[model samples]
Target: MQWLFGSDEDILKLVGRRGSFLSRIGVAVGIKDSDFPVFRELYYEFMEQFKSRYSVYTPRRVFASVDVRGILIDGSELKEYMLFLRDFVNDVVNTSGLYVNFVFASFGTSRISLPGKAKPVSVKTFIESTLKSYFAYIPVWTVIHRTGIKRARVYVDSFSTSPETPAWNELCNNNEVYVVSNGDKVNLLISAADLLLGYIGTIIKLRNKKPDISELKSYLKPFGFNDDRFRIYHVGNRDLGHIIYKDPTVKINPLLYRPFPIVYLIPELSPAGLLAGKDERKLIESSHVYEYILRYVEEQEGSLKIISFTEDFKHLSAGGVVVSLGEHSRRIAEYLRLLGFPLEHLNARELIHLYGGDPRL
Candidate 1:
């Protein structure tokens, strides 16, 4: 296997997602539950040490380091490398600190049911058994400690497939505080504006420390800003989106921009996102419009490669190359013997181990 980038182990470790970003910061700064005052002291000390170094970011390279620890220099491979770092840091936080709890529910057998016949059983038997199991158990303290969110209270509701989410309607009708059902599921209505405001407040809190400007700059470059580009561009949807910017001194222009057609690595699309949101892969796999898009991209002259980035321990049982994009089309020709996709193989076995899977592989 010709290593695609630098050290395979390093790349794999870089992408392993388990921890939380806050825990990573705590570890880096050598702080513990000695509490907020202790954390602030350690944070300042870490900032002072970090400021002693020089950092730089441009289109081709990023350099940042901590004394007596290690240095990272990602050149041209900025996007992938940063992604690895972000995931690693978050995984640390998630494991060492705490993460919000989420529960998934599936409605009963029939998609369409006649009125009154619905028994309204528990979505999962546990919903009737435990308070912790029914609703999303987001720890308010963890959010405050890590993300600096200070939500006063939270309300949860279940939703069904119907217009008013039959579950929510029952709760409202009965005027019940914690009404729940396996049948009628209502939606939990989170206050988006409030969440966004709290998030911004947290960012402001972190920025107030006057962090090493160079370190911040290098950390941000991969999402498309370089020293030469002075302008920024926003594309894609509101929540899951990408941003691009350039510094004027580097002579980079925002106008001459093109988004690379990177392959999406996922186990499967969530049914909720598929039914409520627009997933490109699901749309292409299931619709006639996808055929048109595939034919158009394939007919183009440029060559492309379809890379299968996955884990050896996992498999998408509904195996098929669900989507195709761009001129060069290749598939993991060996992947269960699929064809006509621009294909490259990422060692899924290696990835699984890097993610702390069993040694047997």
Candidate 2:
């Protein structure tokens, strides 16, 4: 059903393109632009032609990190990935006949506990700071290193963080970077960024267990992109030592990062149960201590109903009702969050305390 990728899972999948007709259209849509209809028709023809040429960069397998409490863009492994990603962008720019005028990116969600705070700060705020610091190394650094300047339009996908935040303002003031925080996935190219990010995230979760994570043929079929779309470099134990994309001339300097213990939230898994790793399993298990995770994976064989603690969290074990969760219990919270459910991350005791008592009690 035309799945779009703009979730916490797609944190690293920030899509950006510059010097294209699409970018031009995106930036210049006046309130009384009568040429929109003609432009829209041309855009439709462009999408059809794009699909026919197989020009979309869909990967058979996705690659992502294990979500550890360290730098978001630290270490060589991630560096290798980003450099390769930059190459991929270059490829797209060349193939699509688009100039690299600006790069579009939207920040995804993340959860991290702030010092002296009872809970984590806003997911988007923490991610914004993390990403701003991250770009100082790669893509942004690489662009300046290769092109000799840092002047580009950065269309930010709006999240909780406002464009007026100090970091964002500083970036604009220093770099003349035109900041558009309300970019949407209305165009084909931008949507590819979402797919690309989701693909990396999926692979990161699956790469640890399987030799090649592209085994998700059926899972990816619904999205109209399959394994054959792009090449996957399958190397065991992904580290900086392995030249994944392998560009000998691309020398990488040590990246600077601020260390913070970050807790990654998760979405429901693939149809074949192939998208989670040991770290994710641990995250699911640890939530047991907090009580968001009620039953273990084993306990949820064939239950019905997915829950968001907001509306569906009514305690029910009697009175003609039984509160039960589906097999994707770990993902229920995340799914609810995506659907715009405001769920305060709470432990079982905290929930009981908030609600006075578990109604099932």
Candidate 3:
């Protein structure tokens, strides 16, 4: 119910003060921190609360390009999310500046071209193909320029490429100004989603605090953050469950939502869905995807489960499956194979992409 703003100073002051109140309230809820119970509790409480008070944005900004080395038989599955990986490099370089860091790794699943033999591909192949694919997306480079990203570096598998490959030389040429390989230790390792989420939430609250303020909000404009539908808020202690127990619309469907009984899965959604957006509420709903997503969560007893988003699966049917995906959903499909899930264990999305037709157009 508090007014949200987009100023850093104003937002920081507000969050800095409200931090304690949130800590006490969060414990009352069910949030527990592994290391610093008090600190983690408070930090989450603050983020959720701040999100409630303001808008949060999660941009898939920083990324490593991945290349698929082998052949593919399932055109649909091979190309499903693969388009994003293919164009990702050009997208970053066009949008970012000369000094940004982006790594390229061997990516994609082995099942796209195998006889039930899902081998773990090398990181080198992913990086190589990703850069090679970057060439196809150059026409849209100007559009990215208008969108305000300013830097990019392609990470490569030094062992995978030929001496004469353009990607190798391009990477080598830019080592001083435009690139960083995978092994290099750099200052930024944060998820693009997390950074945008926190940044947007804080900025929105800041704007609300000083309705007349100018400056910080301007930075958001270039990032395309000023749009009206992107509503955010700092989570009030009582509202934390909105993420765990209810949908983004605040609707509850026990059978289809979280905290509901699901076999072999734990539920987690990208925090981006928690913010205001059109129809994004579906991400939090208890559907087949939620079923598998939950099972995956339950499987991760102590490790972190990453939630990645892509339009790759958008072309699929049933909106996709319920299953455990690794850091990348594509990898999850492959990892499941290694874990002994049947080849039929394709995610709902994979099934759709493989056998289902496009419902959007």
Candidate 4:
């Protein structure tokens, strides 16, 4: 009876404010059936203590933003508040035997909304895409392969925008993945995931603001929050890419590829630099290449994997066809060529032309 609980942050609404640097993040925590009761008890106790101490009543769910906004907004209390959440999370993980995985995806709203178009593409579309890419596919794949669990009961916090994509259905059918609404009265794990994602988002913000995070680092070290136990994936943003590349321990296990071959789709840097850019033409072309490859892989019925790659060069050894798009393809091809890994390099426009699809479509 393995269980995986998932929730996401910065998703209900897109951060469209000029010059905002926040990212959408999702968390999935896996635990055994026997550990569920323990986790439930720990969560209840933590909630009780938190409510009593802060006078914030969280009867239904715990939102990191709603519950800890005061602490995060005040620069003076941010550190102390982080430590408090860290201690509680550590207690929960240590006591309940929880395994954590995170995915971070950043999008530039202005870039997504093309200037001349009558209506900009909805941010919800991108959010749904990220949810499908990060939340539904990778976590389930990793959990099944790592835990040796034949099937996992997955509970995801409800998102009005998340549609039942083919990937979701395929994963569910193939792996016995069950989607439970986080709103279910009996589900406390989703709330726990929410809290963890909030903490992670704060940590990212802190890292962006200042250089000194030694205190935070020390607190997270004991629990392996930044280590192998906690897997983290960056979907697109170059900024988050830098963070993932700097820490080798948080990488996706190459062994996950043992069950099936993977197609590593590397897109150009985002306007945010080094991943997909803000240019409408390049972005659209990249999306076309991504969709074409994704459909091609999905046609194999879950026998293949496709993931977005940032700067993590080590995964090149994972033994998969590497397809790089945009101007960055040349650089990636050269790097892989030097490493003796087989490479297929094509710009987004070329891939689109080869596939006989219109980029604007």
Q: What is the TM-score of each candidate against the true structure?
A: 0.17, 0.26, 0.19, 0.47
Q: Can you tell me which runs of candidate 4 are displaced by over 4 Å?
A: 11-23, 55-65, 68-76, 106-150, 161-163, 175-186, 209-228, 236-361
Writing each residue's lDDT as its tens digit, candidate 4 over 297-347 gives 333222222333453455566455555555555576667768786544444
Put the candidates in lDDT order, highest first.
4, 2, 3, 1
**Model 4: how far is 38 from its true place, Å?**
1.6
Q: What lDDT score goes with residue 90 in model 1?
A: 35
lDDT tens per residue, model 2, 84-157:
33433334322332322112233233454444457766545543553342232122222223334334333222
Candidate 2's C-alpha lDDT?
Answer: 0.29
Q: Each candidate: what lDDT?
A: 0.24, 0.29, 0.25, 0.49
lDDT of 3 at 157: 13
Candidate 4 C-alpha error for residue 12, in Å: 12
Ranking by TM-score: 4, 2, 3, 1
lDDT, model 2, position 350: 40
Measured by TM-score, how close is model 4 to the native structure? 0.47
Cα RMSDs of all predictions? 22.7, 19.7, 24.0, 19.7
lDDT of 1 by residue, 1-361 (tens): 1100000000000112443111001000111232324323432343333335434111111111111113333443334334433332233322222112111122223222222434433322312221122122112111222333232222222221222222222323432122111100011112111121122223323444322335534544442222442111111122011011112122211111111232223222332243322454454344333223222222221111122343311222323222323211213224433533443333333333433444243
Candidate 3 local lDDT, 213-254, one digit each (tens):
144345445544323322222222232121121112322111
